[model samples]
Target: MMRNLLTLLFPVLCLAQGTNYNFKEAELKARELVFTQPDSALVIIKKTLANSAGAHDTIKGNTYHLYGLYYNMKGMTDSAIYYYKKSLPYIDNYPKIILRPYINISASYRNKGEYETSLKYLNDALTVTKKDNNKTGEAMLYGEMASNYNYMRQYEKSVDLLLKAIAILKTEKKTKQLYAIKQKLANTYLGMENFNFAIDLYKECLPGFKEIGAEKNYYLTYINIGEAYIRLNNLQEAKKALKIAVDGLKKFDDKELIGITYSKIGNIENLERNRESALKNYKKSLDLLLEVKSLWTLRIAGEYIDILNQMGRYSEAQAIINKTAPFQKNTKLNMVDRVVYEKAIAETYSKTNDSKAISAYKNTITLMDSISSAEKEDAVKEIQAKFQTDLQREKNVVLAAKNNALTKAMKAEKKLLYLYIIMSISFIVLILLYLRSYLFKNKLQQEQIKAVESEKALLQQQHLHELELNNAQKEIIEEKERELTSTTLQMANYQDSITQILEKCDLGEITKVSELKKELQHLIKQKDYWRQFETRFNSIHPEFNQKLGNKFSKLTKNDLEFCSLLKLNLSNKEIASLLQISHESAITKKYRIKKKMQITDDDEFEKILSEI
Candidate 1:
């Protein structure tokens, strides 16, 4: 899951110095790199901080804040908390500035599963922001607290906090943040299964996403809208929305998301009783998901198998079951899907008059019984939750009444205090006038100190960035080498296994014809094994296909596969066996591939493929 809506925060740099140290410029550069090149950003921040030993507290604090964001990005929650806390004392005087660290620390704690501790820090930040009347910070803190509540499974509290956040954003006319919060609120309602509310909020947020040109988010919102419509039994609208989502998702090249979009469209078609269309979409979804090895395939497989069984495509359904059996074996498949698969297995066995039909039926019954019990237990928990939510709301109402009374009383007290302040204003002004020169001198000294620190920071930024970039690049290269070594071993093992099969067939050590036929059929079904290898290769060298395509657009898919095998350093015989071809044929194909790329004798094809 994406990190719960912790809006990416960068430190605010307001340096006014014209000196060469340029702390603000260093900060600006780091902020730009932090999201895309975090290690380099950290280098800049550390160098700026080290050179700023005698600088203004604010500069040091901003560096610490950047450090927090860097660690958070890396998912080092404890380190993030440490850095955020280190910046607190320096920035606490600026409520808007100080609240950021508090909220960040809360997010770190929430991510660590310490929800109560996260809430404590969030409440502290909330108080500070409210005292400062900083609406933006208040809304941000509210949003963070809402995420924490959502983590705690306190959905009611999460919704309430989100509403409070939305209210603040709307009142402040913060259109960007307002719509973002609205989206979150809609998702919260989705979690609560309040489809109408979710759809309403999603519709409200859609225009803002478009206005911001957030195509991905807009597509995602359409997805949510489609899901809501599906739940409402509005299949026509669901199809329209999901089709748009799929079209939009294709632009981003996120295979898993594209698969999910297809799966959802399959659901829409299934609901419309368009069996053939549903099967086609589901098969397409399963293919893409299998390519990515997405966990979602388990859920879709259950539906796909059920549909195949209904259509009397028993062999295809059994093939899918066997293909996904490994995932079902090791992973906690959802109970509903597991039962669906079990029932389909029972039906398949019944058609064959197999004894396993009885066992499959029993398994399905037992699994369904367990699901029923779980649902009952969940129902009881829901009741308990409702009771607690009601009590909490009552308490909130009482607290609001008390706050209203306190506001009235404070207003009266403020009026009296103002009268007294007015009477003493002339004397206070005369005292301030006498001390003005002293304060002016101190301000000048502070500016001089800041200028010196800024100059030092400016000098260190570039050198540190270069040093960090080289180190980061070295680490990346070593990591890739290790990955390549592992993949090469797996491919070698697969090739050896294929060679073993061929040798076994050749020797015919008392093998019957029926056994040989079964073995060949099993081998044919084991194409998924090679597909797994291809998936892993793609992950390690994501740019491989794209690079090959760009260079040799006419390269056949088989040729591209040949290039991947070559990159793994497979020998001609091994590649031939894996690709189900003769050694001479593999060599001819390699020549053709090389010729298409115009590679001469001096060119190292393997080395060139490996680089991609």
Candidate 2:
């Protein structure tokens, strides 16, 4: 394995030795490939520095970049940053490399958690990256900005930059980097409490990791998916996914990941109320941490200790606290990170009934309070300046939140006002529709009343004419003269009145007085009237079509309006109503027509209807 690794390094070494190229780009790439690669990077950075004192400004700026990498690897980050700054003045010509150098310096500062200074360096890098048109470098700069924002807890800004990085990665088609960006996005989503989106991003990363054989990332994706599901309280899915991951990952794998997986498994089992299984998993995680002797893993140890105490396994939990308590003893922990860690420890100690541990916990809390008070007095101006910016940002957030609420309220009010206007218009439309319908019905009723009255007058006149003819009987000339004198003049007057009524009447509306039996029989006698009657009557039976076709086959004029429309299977009421006839009379006339046409009353109307 050592030989193979060195063999890989041989190609990289040859790449470093190529001196014809004035730029030290290949060396930078080789160093970036392995972040922990200080020793191998030393030769190139040394040569670049040697060239710095010469009259070449471009070589000087490049030397600064190489120097930063060498110091960074040695863990002498401050000294490395100082040298890098010292060399930047000599390299005035190489603006492209100058941009990347600032990024390197900023990354070094970021590792030290000097975020404000880091940001200043990042801005320099950004300006340089833009000047050079280095899209990949700009994307890296964006990723760094996103990382910085996340550390500052400016999650929204972080997410925005991360999205920008993803866009750049997509354009570059950097599949592996895109996968890394996806993980960052997923973490940001987790911070924003958007778990569904977080889970989706994590799922997307799996295929990318598989493509690159990135074992760690593939495992992480599985773990993240399980964790996300666990937070959603989808215990069955969480447990199933996590168990598969736990079984698949080897025990001698990445210790932090293995420990985390154990903790997750323990947590899931605990949620299921499987105490024994939970205890076993927790112990497995504890054993791994102890074996690694990793101070970083001690934070996790603190969490497990708390759970163990709750499980009535006080001795075992206490043993862990005793073993890992030394992690905080020698380390230089940042104030905030220290407080959070101590808080985890204190809660565990308080639960375990460990009096000494509890005293230490309380003392630390008191010490933190005292330090905070002193911080206000001693570091007030600097701290206040930092917090002032944070304060202003918070003020802006509050105002923005208020403005959002106001905007939403305004929109709602506008919607309600529009709704009221629409409702008013709708009410007016409905009222108009009702009024129009009522008017149409009233006009039709008036026309029908006039038609009925005309028919009644016609009937009474016919009856009077008949009575006069019957009463003056059997006297030949004398009786005939009397009949003529009494009835002829009256009959002539009645005929004139009937003609005037017919002339005044709407013949279009009053088609037949099928309203009464006498009215119907009277209509059947007139030649012009039967023509109209046949037009209306032949509409009923199927055989009516056969008779009409035979009779009118040679005739030129046609009226489909009355005949064709009525040929459909209509009931007596429908036919009478349509033809301006009474229902009962229409039925009688239909029977008479049926006898004339030779049609059964119900001979499956539609089957015979096809002939028509």
Candidate 3:
């Protein structure tokens, strides 16, 4: 009877095992497709979820997690977070499986720019790592936390966390993860403007990325290295790195990174005065940026417009500016990009309307001030000091352990010495006291050295901070000088127009002379614009007149004025219009100034005035 029952149930057992095997296989296939073919992954995940009813909790949880990954790849972050949270409860009992949902949820919050909330989720994941003693999970959590700190502009904290992650990953022989953390550390250094160090670290990561066959990361490192070189003003090296990145990135469908690479190339071209080539690269960048509706579109649009304006294609510049207007309101727009966009607008309007140009320049300055205020240099220095102190404390802890072991050995030796020679007890006691004193003094000296090193590091950081501040202040002053020049030019144009109108009236015998006179008086009484311009110019560029006069004492007041306009890079036509002179007269005036300054080459003439 028992043998007949076993035979009856044999087919049922095999069918159940087969069903479980198929479910597991489907889950693995979906996981592999989540990033490259999210639609297919979604289809697989839906079927898995439907058929996962009454299955093991691990299977159900994995299916839900795969669903979340599908949403994540689709850029539906909120949906991703929801599904990740749903998976958490199902996988709560399984520490290893639960980590995925926690980490995914944290990434979703990070994408939303809720960095604090992201850290909270990471902390939850950290708890899971501790519970399972999962070193890999701990390292991953540290990397994620470092990323959040980097975004928050806490570079010191970011560096410390990334170092911790790298240490663990190195010990675990996690070559892929070790390289990934190193790349992130390089990025943090890049943000801090430590360009050479960043370049070194980026170079170090490249081989590791290649060894792990992370093709995308390998090329991306080239892009970062390019950026660091660009910041360091090594345009030739920058171009070489970017070219390598461009060639490699073409094999992938990541349009945004490719767009960024093209934009960097555009910058290099623009710097070299290859405006046409720059425009071509910028156009490629803009097209891809627009196709992806990337946030970088506004930034590249600003650059494109600046190039168009430089080429005297005002209509094209204005068209691009108008097209990018809606994106200006996006809160996600980087403040640096906002400044660039506003400066572009201001430059565009300076050609036609002074009032609008002034407004836009003011906006640019305001944005710059906001950026300057947000730097928090002192806080960063304090963080650096604290990090150094923590490192010293860790070293001291190791030293103390060594010292305790030595003291135990010495005590044992002392007992042996006492047993061997009771008569030499006094001599041994004196030697032991002397040795203890020497050890204490050595420890003190080591601590003093550590303190000096910490202080030196803080001083170096402070010096870098001061240099940044000086550069920022110089930038603000240069912008002010530009504003003053525009105001002066506008005043010249206004006075010229008034004089022309009065002359015409005198020639034609206008009927409303009294009304016209009253209007003219009202306009003339609206503050002395030229006086304001001079005062501002002197305040911003305090030694401009003195320096130029000292170099060229033969220059007249009018010659100096022309030189100032030239310093601002005004075109001959614009200068002629501002001075209410004929184009030929403007050219003659420039030649006269050049002769007075003893300059023969046109470029040399402009260079002298610019330096002043």
Candidate 4:
């Protein structure tokens, strides 16, 4: 009877095993495609889910988790969070699968700028890791928590959490995770403005990432190194690092990373004052970032606005500001980007002479001050953390010495007295060495503090100097504008006087009147006055006509002269007087010029001339 029962159940067991194997295979395939081909991954996930009816809870949970990962990679954090939550209940019985959903949900919330909610999820994951005694999972949770703190601008807490994670991962010999956490720690240091340390840590992680076949992470480290180099004003090295990053990142479908890489390239171009090149790179970055709804959009947009303002494209800059208004209001907007955006807006208003510029500048200053304070606090916290770590190391060394002494004492009574003497001398020597090391570290810490303070002072002086230079330039431009307006009005008055004289000569029968009229005609036909005006305009705005002509080749010499007067903020009547045409004719001329330029927008004609 037992043998007959076994024979009947055999087919059922084999079928069940086959279903489980299929689910596992599908999951692995989906995971492989999640980063490089999320759409393909999603198709696999859906098919797996379809076939997962009545499957074990683990299988259902893994499928749902893959769905979440797909959305996360695409930067659709809200949907990612929902799917991650869906997987949690089904995954609760399995520690390995359960922990990932919790952690991933936390990361999604972090991406959404909900740092507090992100932390709560991380804490929940931490509970699971603790319960399961999963050292690796626990370390990973700490790293995730560190990232949340990093985004919050609480760098000290970030560093502390990262160190804890590193400690655990090191003990467990998890090299991949250890380097990953180190990269994160490097990011924190970058935030702290310790570029050298950040660059060193990033370079250290590159080899480890490569060794582990983490191609994405290896490239990302290069990108980060480029950012550090940029901050240090090392453009050559920045370009080299970013080039590698861009070339490597192009092999993957991670648009967000690629977009970020492009943005860094834009930064390099901006630093070089290559406005056109910077704008091009920024546009490329914006296109990809917009598709992903990536948080980096705000930063790159701010940078784009700066370039536009520099190019005298205030209206275009304003358009970008308006478009990104919603992103500005987001609570999770990065503080550094917030400052950049505010500064760009201030520059736009300043260029346009808008009354709101003062308030905008003040806002930028306030944001900058806040960032400076945060940096100072981070520096202090870092020193304290290092001191604490050193103290802990000393305590551990002493404890080890005690254990060694005790072990030696228990070996034999005859040698115990001699061992105690030897151990006492060794303990004193160890204490002396620790004291010397502690003092050296303390001195180094003090020097670092001084260096930070000095750097802050220098930055403040540089900012003041920049403001003064900007003010001087503004004053010079205003003086030139006043001079140009005065010259143009004088020329207009001279022409009016000439016309009156000519009319008087026509009426009177004086013999010299004919010669006077002839002389006036000669003066009017000579173009010497117009040439003087052009020279003065060129003095005030060099390359204005040349640039306009280059951009709008169809514009005639007369059209350029009309545009130049418009650039001086002349009234329509003033413009008509200067051009020796009727007010109606002046308006018609402007319309014709716009037509020739193919500018449909009412403001675009003026905007184009102004930009040129």
- Specify the highest-TM-score model's number: 4
List residue ranges in candidate 1 displaced over 4 A: 1-8, 11-158, 167-173, 191-193, 329-612
Return the clash pairs for model 2, or none. 57-90, 57-91, 61-91
**Residue-wise C-alpha lDDT for candidate 4, range 531-568, written one tens digit per residue:** 78888889878999889999889999888888999998
> What's the TM for model 2?
0.41
RMSD to the native, candidate 1? 41.1
> TM-score: which is higher, 1 or 4?
4
State in Å the error of residue 294, model 1: 3.3
lDDT of 3 at 554: 100
Residues 1-612, candidate 2: write the lDDT tens digits. 000011112111122233455444644553443233445556666665554343345555555555664554444557768876875675545655455556656765665567788899888878877887877667767877776776656788998998898899789876566776677678777766788888999889888766654444466678878888989989888887787677655522445457678888888888888878887887788777666554435556655765765676767766776777776663433444454455555555545443444454554455456456644445534544544454444455545656678779989999999999999999999999999999999999999999999999999999998877766442443544344333333433444444544654455444555434454456445445324334434433336555665754532223332344335445666555545557887767655544544666556333444355
- Between prediction 1 and prediction 3, the one with superior lDDT is 3
On residues 1-612, what C-alpha lDDT tens digit does candidate 3 reach at each position? 000011011111111233554775787577656655668878888887777656777777777777777676554567778888888877788776677777778867776667889999999889978989989778878888887888778899999999999889888887666777878898899989999999999999888766644566678889999999999999999999999998887654556678889999999999999999998999889878777666778878888888888888888788887777778777766677787788777778666433456566666766766666778546545544543454444455545656677778989899998877975887789999999999999999999999999999999999999999999999998889778777977887787868777887787755587867875887877778767876887787688888998889999887876777777778898888877788999999999888877888998887787787
Candidate closest to the true structure, highest lDDT: 4
Which run of 10 residues does model 1 get worst, by summed lDDT? 1-10
Query: What clash count goes with each model?
Result: 4, 3, 0, 0
Reference-based TM-score, model 3: 0.52
User: For candidate 1, lDDT tens digit of each residue in 35-146?
Assistant: 4466888899988876775566778787898888777655456777899999988887877667767877886776555778889998998888789888887887778877
Q: List the residue pairs that clash in candidate 3.
A: none
